[model samples]
Target: MMNMITDMKFLNFFKITACLVGIGVATSACAAGSSVLKIEEEKKVPKIQTIKKRDTASVAILGDSLAVGLYIGLTHLARKNEKLKVQKYSRVNTGLVRYDRYDWSKAAKKISQTDDSNIYILMFGANDLQSIRENSKAYHFQSKGWVKHYNERIDEITNAVKKPGREVFWVGLPIVGKSNFADGYQYLNDMFRARAKLNGITYIDSWDWFANSNGKFQMSGETADGKKRLLRAKDKVHFTPAGYADLGVRVAKEMQISN
Candidate 1:
């Protein structure tokens, strides 16, 4: 009888121990699940904060001399708008075709890494009507090889400036007095437009803005006040102060409309 009683006691002790072990395992599982859920919740907060941080408009103007004029105009506009900021990174007589003189691709990448501006305005191709040298061979302007290489350079600049939550605006070259120059500028504009579309950026067409009613190059145009003023410089390549201011106004209007 005593032996049977001892056996019963052993069975009861085993049942108690098993119940305690089951409770401990359930508690530990719940704690581990809670920790995993907490970690997942923490991971989602930073992305939301990063998106919110990039909501302001800061303009970064880059390119050749034409871009310098546009930057002047934007600088003036920014003075009136407290929220707007404008910065320039342009060089005279520089284009993608002449890499030996000025390597715009490398310059653009460097600028993008350093500048915190969310908006980029680029205007080039004014001086690109030359030969491109690659692999010790020269590709003359308008040739298939030239076009291919020039388009790649465009892609390089576009990719360099493009970032999440950033906007890019490529200003097309305006009409020139010289027929040959105008033809080349038109071709460059076509390429710029196509690449801008493919890269999902904005292309500002300045051709019509500076052209006369007959759609030809004109030295003068009407200002915001509707006053007839000289817009083009003597060389017919660069713009006068008034011309750049008008161009700036056009770009400013675009920025406002986009917002």
Candidate 2:
């Protein structure tokens, strides 16, 4: 439970800080009248604080490298939105149910125990596609039994974190690669949407930004000013910095000030 919450949590900083800027004065060794243009006084950058937010709202992200927000772009988003309490737990390379992989249960336990009322954001499945199952060598999604087990484990995670005044959001996977994986991606996305609906969790569709009118992944994304630009990284599996910014802003907008 804690894993789910911590994984998606982001911090919000509302306080501003002041800094002093000094204009370059002539060094004793230089011409005394020569001076370089510089800031000559202390100034405070007004805090661009998180909007009025619920004291308890939080997010936890879980999944593979994508969920972890690798690359410079994702790191920038995290730095910019530190106040949102968005925790992330993505392994370098893995998916939802690797046989020896870490599960959300461990983290979920901590979040569930917290006294604060908050929301969770779950981002899993990248690794699950080929993850080995518990007590066996078989991978997840290979059989009905395994799928059922996978879904049940998800439920267990939710149950552990269940409480009044709390909420959840599940972000579905986007299409990736250029082959059979595309079909698999769509299937998993469909399952994710269904699971989110059944569990009464908020579902964020990566496809909305990733897909085209014909339902295939769109390599470019719409910018704030409406310009379309390539948003995915070279791998075409993840987003660029601007892409993360777009996603983060959209999320902030959807949450609607949380309070």
Candidate 3:
């Protein structure tokens, strides 16, 4: 009877030890599974796209039909720089000489007040070849009185658009295929260059690009790469896309260099 009681106690003790070992193994397996799940959760976390801050410049294009052409090229060029912003304010067949139709000074001042622009591009004198309305009378183009009145109008427009931190670039008129129109544009370019210098504005001379070696206007012009291409349209007043592209690239390069 004593031997049987002792053997029973030993078997009971062995059974208890096996139960403890099984519990420990299960607990260790559960802990390992939990560690694996935590690693997977970290891997499933999404990555976010972040935009970097860049240098920026605000540009305003102000003028007539020629300005519209310039704006097309300028806008294309500005997009090359992710930070460049371009605003266009162009009037078709409008100029400083024709204030009765559309006053440039008032328009410029309004636009300047509306936006904070660092660069201002001025291109005009296309429709200024016609007669100007001054003091309740019409003055013929190229006349002494007409020139004087036009100069005053130019000064008014230039001064009105200026702000504290704005830099102005006055682009000269390009040569037209018509001799009479070319003459008018040449005279206007002279006035533009002189007034721009007087008002502390940079003048961009576009005549040489459109003019041939003989200093005459040509429908086909050489690009920056010296490849001859059709740059002018049939009307001779506006530029072809290729012409604007070439000019726009050059202008953009100059703008970058200026800074």
Candidate 4:
């Protein structure tokens, strides 16, 4: 009964997250036809305007709600370093697929104008597991055509942020409380890792940071003092405040921000 309850919790969490992202359980059937879909050519990275260099430093945080949690954590840790200014450009519920709602490539250009700093922290894809509209065509999630279109968008966003003397830290998605959600994230993470490497950006793997000892999704994790604390929010999607702060500390350190 205990095992059954645990399994049910995982299933419920997966279904809820997928539904919230506008992906219905019926969408799983779309996966079968993915191989039959035609893949498009990957977009070439274009040259963006050269942003002004300044003595001041800033780190632009970009993505969806997960980026908001990441920003909250980064703000607490990065403020200690007076030289580093952490700015958030993330919009909640926005993803690479939802240009009609919000476009990160365009947002990146505007943010570059405001900050003009070299460092960037990008975390996306939590809200992107649904169908995507491309060139008057719609591609379902996990489809080969969807993969092609998604990669193109990722490249577009990455290129829009690249400037002279700039560094981008692309943070990968963390493991959620459901196996299906975890699988989706794993696919997204692989894309992030490959694309970040291809684009010469740093990719931050966050799966283990929120995973259990057995590499499973877990709600609680050990702090620096080895004391276990709740790291997940009730939704099992976003992080708790404590969880974000802890994760932010790691990110700040990775960005070389020290007081």
Every candidate's lDDT: 0.81, 0.57, 0.77, 0.79
Error of model 3, residue 87, in angstroms: 0.8
Q: List, residue by residue over 44-163, the lDDT tens digit for candidate 4.
A: 432333333343567888899999998898787666657767888888989998898997888887887778766888999999888998778999998999999899989888878877
Model 4 C-alpha lDDT versus the unseen true structure = 0.79
Clashes of 2: 37
Candidate 3 local lDDT, 1-259, one digit each (tens): 9999999766544444545456444555555555555776667543221212236767788899888888888777666766778888987878888788888988988888887787778999998888887778888998988988888878787877777667677888887887778888989999998787666667788888777899887889788768889999888878898788776666655555221
**Candidate 1 local distance difference test against the native:** 0.81
Please provide TM-scores, in order, for all candidate models, with all chains considered together: 0.76, 0.66, 0.74, 0.75
What lDDT is obtained when candidate 2 is compared to the true structure?
0.57
- Any idea what lDDT model 3 has? 0.77
Residues 13-83, candidate 2, lDDT per residue (tens digit)? 11111111233432431222221112211122221212334533456555567666622333444455555
In model 2, state the lDDT of residue 237: 76
Name the 10 consecutive residues with the lowest summed lDDT in model 1: 46-55
Order of the predicted models by TM-score, top scorer first: 1, 4, 3, 2
- Assess candidate 3 and give its TM-score to the true structure: 0.74
- Per-residue lDDT, model 4, residue 179, is 64
lDDT of 1 by residue, 47-110 (tens): 2112122324688988998888889877776667667788889888899999998999999999
Instruction: Give candidate 3's error at residue 76 in angstroms.
Output: 1.5
